[model samples]
Structures are given as C-alpha cells and as structure tokens.
Target: MPSSVPSFAELLNQCERSAIHLELRDCYASTERFEAWKRGERIDWEDRESWWHPYDQLIAETVARGVSVRRARIVSEPVSEYIRWEHYVTHANVTAGEEVRWLPRRQATSISLPGNDFWLFDGALLRVHHFSGDGVVVEDEITADPETVKLCSAAFEAVWERALPHHLYTI
Candidate 1:
C-alpha cells in the first residue's frame, strides 16, 4: 500500500526519538520576513507573545513531549543577506527548543549529500523539500526508501558533527 504523506507539523507531532532537518540552501524565499529584514526591521525577541503565537507553541509543546528537534544548514562562507537575517532570527528557534547548527559549503565538498533539503523523523521517514532556482519552495516529498534514508542519515550526521552551533555561527 502507498503510504499517505503527512504534513510537516504532523511529522513533528509524531516524532518519538528525533526530528532532524538538513538544509542545503543559503537563502529561502520566505517573503514577508526577507522584506522586513531588507527594510532593517528586526524581530523584537522581547515581544514573544506577538511573533510566536502558534509556531513557537507547537515546537515548544513537541519538545516538551521529549522529541528532539535539530536543524543543520549548509551555507556559503560569505552568506547571503537572507542568512544574516536568518541567523539573527534563529534565536526564536532556540527559544522554541530546536537545536540548530551551521556548516559552511567549503567544509562539505567531500560529503555525499542529498540533492534536496529533508527532515528525517525518528530515523525512519524522510520528507524532502524542493525549492525553485530563486529559492522559493516548490514541493515536499515523503519517502521511506531504505537506501535514501541511510544516505540522508549519514550525510546529516557528518554535517552536524562539523557544524557550529547556532549561537557561535556568525554570518
């Protein structure tokens, strides 16, 4: 039987052991915030209730349930403006209980990585993200292919091991 694909939120909710994400992009076209950052508007981390309404609650609750959430990113050395903004805003992720790490592209040259970004849930399911050339999200794929899962697991571990934690990674 073909398995039904679950939403990202569902994947997180159902995660028992861990929810690990590997991002191989320098920038994502998350419009509103990108524009806000471009305009020199920063996220007021002090105003948590306003900005963290639902997303943060979800992550916090999931973490409370004992699910380990981690995100690893592969970025270029001289990062894009988006990365700078993202680095600044990552405090929200940490506040929400996610562990994030940054790995420079130069450090990953020899690693065999998947072609797309992915979230591995409990080391069993893989949800791959496809992005357009300009960095807009296009689609997400969910799979349980054993070989692919093994590859992603190995690649993510390699990058995660070498990557710097969010606080120490400066753009």
Candidate 2:
C-alpha cells in the first residue's frame, strides 16, 4: 500500500494485519530465527538474526490473534538443511499444522519480472535491480505498483502448489 518495497519486518507486520502468505526461494536466515524462537532461545546477534526475529513474533502473535500464517519456501541442498533445522525446532514448539508449506527446488518455479524490482539469491550472490515507475526503472528503483505486488502473490502460489507435506520430513 505504501509506495515502497516493504522491508522484511514490514512485510511480516503486514501479515499480522491480515492473512499472510510468503514465498521464500531460500530461507536460511528466516528459518534459523524461527528455530531459535521456537526453542525460546534469545536470538544471536553476531550472525544474521535480525531478519527473522520480527517474523517469528509476527507468526506467533498472528496465531494468537486468530490469524493464520501460511508460508511456502523453496528448499534444496543447502536450503534443505535450513528446512530440516526449522522443522525440528518448530515441531518442538508447535505441532505440525497446515500453516507452513515447504517446497524442494526441483519442484519450484522460476520467477521472472516484467521489470527488475526483484532480487535473486543463488546461495551465492544476491542481485537486486532497481526499477522506476515506468517499465523497469533502473538506478532509481523506488515505488511499486499494485500489479507488481499481485505478481509477487501469484509467484508465491505457483510455488506453494508444488510444496511438500511437512510430515514427509523427519523434523
């Protein structure tokens, strides 16, 4: 709704405001914090824990407030390791429910942007391109359109459809 790309925390806060759905290509950092919170452990600061703390609270609070949080993440190889970690930790805190969806990369779909407001992380580089209000606005990528947000939602659905049942994993 604001003319800006929502920060990860802002996005989770948005989720708290309404039913929230997210598509994660790789969620190592997020899953880690989720695991920590599930274990009731204070987040570690030396590592990349900031991105997840707010999200963890958002999920817990959302559930407490009777709002559901549904997530779909693309997992494979290294990413799968994080899934295993998150699965173990989350299960320890809460029983398996229909709230989270995990997808293997092979079954995941690639996302293409009409203009590059999108970011890509290949377990290596995190590439981000800027876009202007016009087509793919470069150098001054600031605002986002309702259509782009809709496209992001569609991308999440495409991946969610291919995700696996949580019980399938030992965690």
Candidate 3:
C-alpha cells in the first residue's frame, strides 16, 4: 500500500461525479459496535437525534452536489451476524442519499475482483483498504494510478450490475 495520501474525507470532498464502494468482507473484527447492537441497542434511523453523525452530513453534502454515492457488498448467503447487523442498519446509508446493494458471494465466483475492498471516486482515484486477519483496517492506500482505478471501477460496475438493491435484499 502507498502512503502520503489525503484523508478519506478530503478525497470524498474532491469527488466531482461519483463515489462507489466495493465491500467484499462478510465480517469485520471491530466488535464494539457489533457487541452494542448484540446487546439489543436498537437503532431508529428516522430518529436523527440518535443515529445521525458528521459522516452522514458528509454523505448528504456529496449527494447534494450530484455526485452519486453507491455501495455494493458481496457476502455469503448465510452471512455473519455482523453482515446481518449491517443489513439492518443500511437504512442510515440510504437515508443519507447513498444507494446500497448486496450480492451473494456465490454469484461472484466468475468475476475477477480485487482482494481488498475499495472506494472509487469519480472513476479517477481508488482508495484501497487493507485489513488484517481479524478485520482491523491496517492500511488505506489512495492511488491515482490509472490501472488501479480502471480495475476497481470495472469490478464495482460488474458487482453493481448483479447486486440487489437494499430495499429488495433480505438478511
């Protein structure tokens, strides 16, 4: 992974057309949030006082500028509890104007996808994420390398073409 990159927020703010994310993991080891939810702390996304955050504000700002924000996740059919929690809370993302989708991992066997998750901004910059075995985010590499961007953009589109929209997806 490369260094000397701007913050994710800074890169997002620079986006002019689109921000597409490809999430290939079924579980993440950041267990704090998951444990809280597991303890039955319910979320009311409509209750902005409870679920809103600066990140939501950023997404709103980006979408307001007509820069489409989309996320596609490919998970195994019988997903992890974390993936189920993610599906439950996806309303927060949709509420902020970003589009979300889910694709079963079995459906992706034929596609050529990157090993790491990534965020492609405006089809120009690729923010590739590297995670440890336990799913901790170890590195975030930002690259303007045409090859990386092209590959990520193509992979995201391929997933998007087959993924089910959030509204239609079931845990």
* Model 2 lDDT per residue over 21-127, tens place: 44343333344456666577753443544434444654566567654545555666545544666665554223312266666666653654233323221111112
lDDT score, candidate 3, position 102: 97
Worst 10 residues of 2 by lDDT: 119-128
Residue pairs in steric clash, candidate 3? none
Which is superior by lDDT, 2 or 3?
3
Indicate the TM-score of model 1: 0.94
Can you give the lDDT of residue 95 in candidate 2?
33
Cα shift from native, residue 82, model 1 (Å): 0.9
Off by over 4 Å in 3: 1-3
**Per-candidate count of clashing residue pairs (backbone under 3 Å):** 0, 2, 0
lDDT of 2: 0.47
* Candidate 2 error regions (>4 Å): 1-57, 77-80, 92-98, 110-144
- State which candidate has the highest TM-score: 3
Q: What C-alpha lDDT, on a 0 to 100 scale, does residue 144 get in candidate 3?
A: 86
TM-score of every candidate: 0.94, 0.49, 0.95
What is the per-residue lDDT of model 1 for residues 32-149, given as tens digits with 9 covering 90 to 100? 8779879988777788876785777888999999999999999997998888888888888899999999999999999999999999999999999889998887788899999999
TM-score computed on alpha carbons, candidate 3: 0.95
Cα lDDT, all candidates: 0.90, 0.47, 0.90
lDDT of 2 at 126: 18
